[model samples]
Target: MPSHRAAGLVAGLLWLASLWLPAISLAARHADMDLQAFEQNGWWLLTAGWVGIFSGQPAWLANLLVIGLVPTLLMGKQPPWWVSLACAALSLLSLALPGTTIHFDGGPYRVVAFDIGYWLWLLAAQIPALLMLTELNVRRRAK
Candidate 1:
């Protein structure tokens, strides 16, 4: 297999593994809130996050977009480099999640920290783009 395809496989595996890891820690703004700090795993977010969109939290869309990377990398002989780059850009939208308030269980919560899963997910989204860029650079140099 080509290096880029190998890299894409690795990325896809990383993303799948990250699904079982904790992605974020959320804290209630009020001291008296029934729930305190809550850790949400990637699987939970990926499976149930569509509700966030209805609740006006579009950042979850970024998480959803990362799925695009899997097929783009695995389905074809080679996808355009720009497609991978676009996936990378969309994956970064999760960065906007930190300061945004989310309504959960009738309470407002803020994301206080990103965990390993989040970083891994971001990395997975980026790997294809990075590899494609390097491949393009190598091709240019061969000219």
Candidate 2:
């Protein structure tokens, strides 16, 4: 019932918001961001460059974000026998990545509970939007 453009816009907005949430959380808590580790591998640079690129054309990037989430949904690691496993897998992946954590209990590392939740929740929304768009495209082609 929705258009590809609509899907893209929604997904894009959510994706962009998702990226910012972690930074905001960290700042709010006065938590130490492991920037040195994030920078050492050029991952941060690559990520920043990516965000910049997405900034130019958010809708298309949103579609891409949805596509990316499909893999996570399929094989991540939650546990619902459906989208759960993949969400779980994505949670683990989120943990593995930089700039995703929470630390307020006098620990060396930030906890990743919120990071994984945000990523997976946003992803669940994205994956369906993408699938709807894909189906729409297919139906149009058939007609």
lDDT of each: 0.75, 0.39
What would the TM-scores of all predictions be? Answer: 0.82, 0.33
Give the CA lDDT, 0 to 100, for residue 39 in model 1.
89
Model 2 lowest lDDT segment of ten: 37-46
Best by TM-score: 1
Could you give candidate 1's per-residue lDDT for residues 27-49 as a string of tens digits?
88476646688889989878776
All models, RMSD in angstroms: 2.6, 12.6
Highest lDDT, which number? 1
Kindly list the per-residue Cα lDDT of model 2 for residues 33-116, writing each as its tens digit: 433221111222224424433334222233344455444434432212333234334333433333443233354333223443
